[model samples]
Structure formats: structure tokens, C-alpha cells
Target: MEKRLLGKTAIITGSARGIGREYALRMAKLGANVVITDIDLSAGKYKETDIKAKSVKEEVELLGVKSLEFEGDGTDESFVKKVVDDTIDTFGSLDILVNNIGGTGGAGPGLATDMEVEKFRRVIDINLTTTFIFSKHAGKVMKVQKSGKIINVASVAGFVPLFVVQPHYSAGKAAVISLTKTMALELAPYGVTVNAIAPGYISTVKWDAHFEAQIEDLVQKVPLGRIGTTEDCSKVIEFLATDLSDYLTGQTIFVDGGLMELNPSSSKIENYQI
Candidate 1:
């Protein structure tokens, strides 16, 4: 196997678990030193989940690449700056940045009209603002080097409304896509490439039991006839991290198994009117 990302140093936010964890591990295997950070710290009264940052860091180190773990809020400007600073100080250079920190605020489903204004702002802060903070800080370092790759983790829900998750989550993700495009254009002159990966219906242990039925129903809607996995998203991130996608920027790649192409599938025949 060729080491596509050899000599590269990558910082991945929310890498304690889920798709972010997969990205960290896969990048390490491809010969990139990885830095994993997450807001979830098991220090206080909160129970430690399986997808903790320490575990992901350990796994990355096991791959024979140096790994650093940090516990901080992604939405914090100073925190994000520190993450970039630490990456440079420890690794000597920053080559790739994966902005994967985002969530629906653990708030259950609700209509756009009924969603609280505060909750909406929180979602935007976590998903969109954090992306901006990381990209801006990382861009500064990469600009000086004249070469770097930045991959933002968007969601298929941003393109097509899922209706199951909050509308705020979808909107924030859409903003992420827009931010990615803008950054790509701005950073292109410096030899930096920025892009986004919109993953669809990934099956993870974090899904609530009630979502199981919804997940099963969604599988039929996917042309590939199966829900996506964390590894599915990881492979795409891996590609974006390598020189193979150097020419690609200001683009959003949908890892939806062809679901994004069809407006309505056979499964949605009953809802299709056109």
C-alpha cells in the first residue's frame, strides 16, 4: 500500500468517535500524524462514552503515528487557535485539517417553526462557526507553507431535508458547504485546497433506539440498498487528504451512494407527483 499522506500532519475535530474517529484512524494508516480533539471529556459527572477522544488517540498511536488529544470546545476561537498552534509546534507543520465537529444539540426532532431561537443559534455555532474558526486559523498556517488540504464534514441532510433531524441542523450544514466554497477560492492562490464531504445515513451506535425504525426505512431509499458506515465516510476523507484530490476545491462530494441524484425513488413513488 502506498503512503498517500506520508509526512503530513492532520488535525481532526470531534475525532473522539463516529465518522471523525474513523477519519483519524484512516489518515494515520495512510502515514499522516493525526491530532484528535473533542468537547466530550469524561472528567466530571458525565459518563465516558465509547467514542472518547483518548481512545481514538490511542488507536492512532497504535498505527505507529504520533497522535495528540485535546479536550476543548470547537466553537471557541481561542481554543481552535490553540489547536492549530499546538499542531504546528509539535509536528513542525500542518498539512491537513478535517473540521468534523457538529451535532443537532441532542435536541429531539421539531419543526423549523417550533424550534427555539437559542437552539438554532447553538446549532449554527457548533456546525458553522466552528468550521470557520478552524479553517481560518488553519488557513493562516497553510498559506505560509503554500500547500495544504482542508476537508469540512457536511451532511447530505444539508442538500436534501431529512425531516427527521432538526431543520437547524440542515441549515447549518448548508452554510458549511457555502463556507467551504468561499475558503477554497480564497485559499486557492496559496496552493490550499478546501472541500466538503456530505455523508448520508451513516449507521452508528449513537443512534437512539427510536431511530432504528427510521434507519431501516431509510435504507430502502438509498440506491445502494444499505445504510452507510463510518468507514464509508472515512475513505472519502482519506482521498481528499491525499494529493489525488489536490486539484479539487470549492466542491461538495456527496457520499450518498447515488441517492442525491434522484429527486424521488421507487420507494417514494407514493409521494412523487410529477
Candidate 2:
């Protein structure tokens, strides 16, 4: 770790567990003061990733960087604004914002036609609306300061249909990718870079269980012949968060192990419902 993000402050949404947790840890390891926010700080228990520290905030603090923890709805504009305000109040600067709060959000049919309206809306709010609200408040600060990094986490499902039934998830992520581009254009002049990372078949604790039976079949579909990991996704965030990407903005880097390039599909396993 070369401390690429030394002295910066980063706020990662839904960072109590899963890929979001990885983002928090990686940024902290790079020396950024990390703020962890999620509806449940103990969310990792649901997926069996809870660490000895019991929470991501403590985990980050153990890495020798300042850490802030907030428990709230990432979609709620008020809470998001407070988080942004507090981040600036505490760290004196908000250098990075990773909009990582999102998920499939339902175990229903996930069909575009008959899925419950509530489920569809939940997916969109968590994925797209949260991103918008965070960026709006953070962009205000970054614009005035004229330097910042905003990374939106998307999914390969946004680019192509999935063997899993996640039309709502797909639609929400697609919107995130589009939102990244538009945000980039608006913030570029202010020296703020906005980018999105679309991950494919990542094997998080929850996902590992969800795709347990289909892992082999799914790996075969990926051109790289492997499932992606949280580290794989975090590396892209590292790039977008650091000065290495000073010249890049409004881009969606696919951390899919070449699965997207192959136009992936899985016929061996039955349609997995999310």
C-alpha cells in the first residue's frame, strides 16, 4: 500500500458488508479517512462476513485512518445530506464519494411485467436515487473546492440481460451508468471526476450462496474462466479514486473478467431468481 489516498476523506454507502465493505477497507488501506454508512452496521452477519471488529468503522480505524459510521437509509435525502455535511465537518474535505449502496432488492419474479411495484421501486431507490442524492450534496462541496472523485458501482447486468431474473436490478444499474456520464459532464469543469464500475458475477458472501450451485456453470460462461472478486472491483475504485485517473472521467470500467465482452449466458443452470 503506497498511501495513494493519503489525507483524503471518502464516504462509502452500504459499506457495512459485501463489496461495499471491501471498498471501505481498500480506501482506508490507501490512507483515506473512511466514512461507513448503511441501514445496518451488522449487515455482514447476514452474509457471514462480520469481522472480529464487528463493524466496518472499527475495521477502518484499525487500519490507522479516521473512520466515521452512520446508520441510516442511503436513499433518504436528509440522511445523505447530513452524512455529506458531517464528512466535511469532520475531515475538512470530501475527496471521494463511492455510491455503493444497491442490490437486487427482491427475491420475487423480478419480471419486468409482473414484479410488484414496491419491489421495483425499492431497487431503483437504493441503486439510482441514493447515488443521485449523495452526488448532489457532495458535488456541491467538490464543485466549490474544484477537486473530487465520485465512483458509482454498477453491474454487468445493466449492460446485458442476466440468467438471473433481475430486470429491476438491471434497469436501476443501467440508469446508474447513464447517470455517471451525465454527472461527469456537469462536474468535470469543477475538477470532479465521476465514473462507474460494472462488476460481473462477483463472489461475495451473499452471492456465493446465491450462486453456489451454479458457480461452475457461471464460471464457464465468463471468457476469463473465473468468477470475479471484491478485490477485482476494489482495484478499479482505487484507480478512479486516485490521481492515476486524473485524465479520465465519465467512464464505466467493466470488472467482469471479460464476461461482458463475450455476451454471457448460462444455460446449464435454471434461471436464478434474485
Candidate 3:
């Protein structure tokens, strides 16, 4: 809000909607030029944010900062490389990279033993591989500049086991956390900090629409006594994206409402999903 990232450039993946969208808007509010990249730029057709514009890119421009919109598959290495190149060519500097493109890919059976082969692979590619590709290209630019921040979006599922299904999602996120630490060490010499935010029970348009009836029940399990908002997740990204976290690297900050502290075992909880 104080324009801490003034004149900076941030590229957020899967930011057409959900928590990623919040990250883009937050960066823009801090005076950073935002690049809205997603497989579907029109993905937000399901719901609307408070600041209504023709699109998220428009919303960012409304904040008095430049915005670039690129729609492409996150798993495509060529597309990702182009995004990185084009951002540098236009922005003159790559100050921030938020790897927010990931999901369960809900195509396979949920159980570990019963998980579908293709679905599991797709989940890993979208979450882990996508992160690596962006970091690889973006790191090249950041390393040259000798300053940058990379914030990866992980999930509580990566840290703890769940009674619910979706083993592929869990495994993919766990790998992301590991990758973040590795990248942190690799990029530290270049003054590039790599960190991750693992959120829990965030209420997004798609999540709410799917679990609307179970919202209250899910909140009851959270010690905070409420559902987490996209802003809750984005605020943490803000910290990691700014100088405030300059000293921190190779860290995974959990944005959960103390949900992981419980460390609930599968036997204790019945099919709970985070």
C-alpha cells in the first residue's frame, strides 16, 4: 500500500483468479508493474472481485501501473521462456516472480493406490515442473540484475497428510517446497530470495462454489474460527516479495490458521481437505 515495490515488475502465474489474482493486485497496489499470466486469462468468468474491470489486467492498470497479459499453458517451457524474455524486454527489470500456477487437476481417483497415472503426472507438471521452468528463466534475469524475489505458492497439503483424497496434489506441493529451498540456495549468491507460502482452507471462487455447503463445517476445524481469504495469502506474498523479507530465504511460511499445529492424524479426522 505504501508503494514499496514502485517501478518494480512482478509476474504472477495462474493469476487470472483465486489467490493468484490477489497477489497480482497487491503487487500493483504497491506500485509494481504486474504481468498477469495464466492458461486461461478468462478464467475468472465464474465470479468477480470487488474492483470490477474488463479483466485482471485492467484492474492492475487501474491502480496506475502498467500491466501485461499473457495466456498460455504453464507447463509449456517455450511459452514460459517467452514470457520471461518479453517481461524483461518490456519492463527493463524482473523484480519479482510468484509461482502461483498449481492445482489438484481433479481428473483421477483420489486415493494414492488408486490414483490415475495421467492425472498424477499432470499434477506434478503443473505444480512442480511449472515452478522450475519459470524460476529457471526468471532466475537468469534476476541473477544478472543481482536482485529479485521468488515467491512460490505451496499448500498445507504438502506439509501434512490429509484424511481426504488427492495424493497427487499433496506430493506435487511437497516437491515445490523442496524445490523452493534448493532454488533459494542456488539464487542467494545473486541476491535473489526464494521462499514459499503454504496456505490452508483458502476461500476462493472455485473452492467456495464447490464446497459452499461445507464451508461452516470446514471453518469449525480451523483454530482461527473462520475461513481464510485470498488476501490472507497475498499479504504473506507481499512480505516475501518486498525488502521486509530480504534476510529470509529457503523458508516456507504457512498461512494456515494454525491448522497444521493440530497435526491431526487420518484416524482423528474424517476426510478433511485443506
Candidate 4:
């Protein structure tokens, strides 16, 4: 087996669990030392669930790559700066950054009008603002290296409404999509590529916790005839992180089963079967 990212280092935020955890594990197998950051670390309990930074680190190390776990709020500017600095100090180079943090918290299934201002702001911080902070700090190190790959985790909500009611979450993810374009342009000259991955209906253990209801009806809508898996998303990230996607930048990849950017009324296919 060949490793494309041998000796390279990657920083993936919110990697204590779910999609982010998958990224850390996969990247390690691809021979990239992994830096895993998550708010769950700040609480020092992994997560309310069983997945924790320690478990992720152990798995990544088993793949024979160094893994660093930092505990803090990803939305904090100072914390982000420190994390970036520590990455360079420890690994000596920052090769890839996966900004995979964002979600709707306590206030579940909310209409825009019914949401509290504070909650709205909180969602934005978790999703959008944190992306900005990570990208900005990570870009600095990549700029000095004169080469880097930055991948942001947007959502299908960034492009279209989902079955769930999450107005603020949608807005924040859309902003991340926009940020991908702008960052790509800003960092292109520095030999850095910035892109966002918008995923739809990815089924995870975490998803079962809050969004099992979304599964039944949503799978039928996907042209691929099934919901996505975290590995499905990570494989795409693996591509974008490599030089094979060197020409790809300033773009958003919709990792849906052809569910997004579709006009259901005008599709040539009347129905899709698995």
C-alpha cells in the first residue's frame, strides 16, 4: 500500500466523535499525523456518549501516526490560534485542515421566527464562526509553507432545506459554503486549496440520537437509494486533501446521493431505484 500523505500532518476539529472522528481515523491510515480538537475535550469527558478524544487518538496511533488531542472551544479565537501554533511546534508543518465542527444544540427543530436570538447566535458560533477562526489561523501556517489543503464541512442544508426544521443551522452552513469560495481565492496564490463538503443524510450513531425520524423519508429521495455513511464523506475528504485534487479549489462538493441542486419537477428520471 502507498501512502499519499506520509509525514504530512492534519488538523480536524470536533474529531472527538461522529464524522470528525472518522476523518481522524482515516487520515491516519493514509499516513498523516492527526491533530484532533473538540469541545468534548474541554469538558474532559470525551462526549456525553462513549466516543472521546482518547479513543480516537488510540485508534489513530494504532494506524502508526502521531495523534494530538486538544480540549477547548473551537469557536474561541485564542484557542484556535494556540492550537495552530502547537501543531507547527509539534509536527513542524500543517498540511491539511478539516473544519468539521457545527450543529444545532439544545433548541432542536426550530423555525426561524420561533428561535431565540441567543440560540441563533450560538448555532452560528458552533458552525460558521468556528470555521472562519480555524481557516484563518490554519491558513497562516499553510501560507508560510506555501502549500496546504483546507476542507470545510458544510451541509446539504447550506443549499436546500432538510426535513428537519433548523433555520439558523442552514444559514451558518450556507455561510461556510460562501467561505469556501472566498478562502480558495485568497489562498490560491499561496498554493493552498480551500473547499467545502456539503453532506446529506449521513447516518451515524450520533444521527440516531437526534435525527432517526429523518431517515425513513429521506433515503427514498436520494438518487443513490441510500443514506450516506461517515466513510463516504471521509473518502471525498481524502481526495481533496491530496495532490490529485490539486486543480480543484473554490468549489463545494455535494456529497449527497444526488439529492441537492436537483429540480425534482424537471429531472429526466421519474424515479431512482437502488
- Point out where model 1 deviates above 4 Å: 41-54, 208-210, 263-274
Give one digit per residue, the lDDT tens place, for model 1 in 1-274.
4788888999999877667777888899999999988897332112224443347777788888998889999989899889899899999999999999887757556666777888888888989999999999999999999999999999887876665446788889999999999999999999999999998777766653446656666677888888888889988998899988988999999888777775375223121110
Candidate 1 has an lDDT of 0.82
Enumerate residue pairs that collide in model 2: none
Superposed model 3: Cα runs more than 4 Å off: 49-51, 262-269, 272-274
Model 2 residue 204 distance off true place after TM-score fit, in angstroms: 0.8
**What lDDT is reached at residue 126 by model 4?**
90
lDDT per residue (tens digit) for residues 1-274 in model 2? 9999999999999998989999999999999999999989888864644574867888899999999999999888899999999999999999999999988554445567777888888888988999999999999999999999999999877777675467778789999999999999999999999999999889888888777887897787888888888899999999999999999999999899887676435323336754
User: In candidate 2, residue 101 scores what lDDT?
Assistant: 90
Q: Give Cα-based local distance difference scores for all models.
A: 0.82, 0.88, 0.88, 0.84
Model 4, residue 94: what's the lDDT?
98
Models 1 onward score TM values of 0.91, 0.94, 0.95, 0.91
The better candidate by lDDT, 1 or 2, is 2
Query: Considering only N, C-alpha and C atoms within 3 Å, which residue pairs clash in candidate 1?
Result: none
Error of 4 at 235 (Å): 0.5
Candidate 3 lDDT by residue in tens digits, 79-122: 99999989989999999999999986556437777766888899
